[model samples]
Target: METLLSIIFIYIFVENFVLHRFFGICPFLGVSRKMETAIGMSMAVIFVMTMATLVTWLLYTFVLIPFNLGYLQIVTFILVIASLVQLVETVLRKISPTLYQGLGIFLPLITTNCAVLAVTLLAVRLEFAFIESIVFALAASVGFSLALIIMAGIRERLEMANMPDVLQGSAVTLITAGILSIAFLGFQGMLSL
Candidate 1:
């Protein structure tokens, strides 16, 4: 329990997906112009990432490991994540049209989000146990969402603030992300579990 808690804390604040891992920067910069879009993207990512981690972990352990085909991890994980994103899209469309609309085009884009793939790969590389893998996945997703939402909020406010011509859009955003990453680094030694 302590280890799981520590992992969650580290993933969320210390080793955040965006700040630390630098995965999924495309959407982190592209889709974070609006808070609503950011929230929707974050939620979709969280759901897809958690499910993808679980499915990939099972496949890697039971199927690939049994066959000694671990070298195929990347290809196999991508296929699983793609299929899972499709399934989630279909289910959301049928069950919640509002959410489908809110998610907009980003829902499908989840297929290519490196953060999800990175989380699965990290779990495998670390050889996390079943529960630990799930916790890590969930924590990573939460961290991604936190960073996305915060960036969106800041961007929303930045629209009204004066900015230098050269550092207006992507330039300033990247700088802000760098600052946030430095801030997150402060949490590194907070917990040693």
Candidate 2:
């Protein structure tokens, strides 16, 4: 139980895929201009990451290892993740046109998002249990969402604050992300398995 809690803490605060590991910076910066868009993307990511983890884990444990096909992990993982993204895109388009429009090109971009791929690959490499991998992926997705929402909130405020001409737009966003990453690192020694 302690190990589980530690994994949650580390993934959410210590090893956040965005602010800490820096996996999905493209959408982190591009789609975070609005709180709604950020939230939508986050929800979509959480769903995709968790689903991808589940599918990949089942495939690896049941099929790949059984047939000495371990070498095909990456290819198989990508196929699963891409299909999940497409399903998510379809659902979002039908359920919420506003969010669908807000997400724009970024929706399909999730297929190529490194964070999703990283979570799937890491879950297999780390040899997590069925439930453990689900939890890990969930924690990572929440961390990504937390980071994105925090950045969106900050950017909203930064828009209102006075700043020099040179430090506008992505310049300020990058600087803020740097500081946020350092803040996450401060969690060092806070939790350990």
TM-score of each: 0.95, 0.90
- Write candidate 2's Cα lDDT for 1-193 as tens digits: 7768888998999888998788999889987888887887898788788988999999999999999999999999999888877877888799988777765456677898899999999998988888889999999999999999999998888888898989988999999999988888898778765
Residue 48 lDDT, candidate 1, scale 0-100: 90
Writing each residue's lDDT as its tens digit, candidate 1 over 1-193 gives 9899999998999888998889989989988999988988998898899999999999999999999999999999999999999888889899989888877578789988999999999999998999999999999999999999999999998888898899999999999888888888888778754
What lDDT is obtained when candidate 1 is compared to the true structure? 0.91
- Runs off by more than 4 Å, candidate 2: 91-106
- The prediction achieving the highest lDDT against the true structure is 1
- Tell me how many residue pairs clash in candidate 2: 0
How does residue 86 of candidate 1 score in lDDT? 88
Alpha carbon lDDT of residue 40, candidate 1?
87
lDDT of 2: 0.88
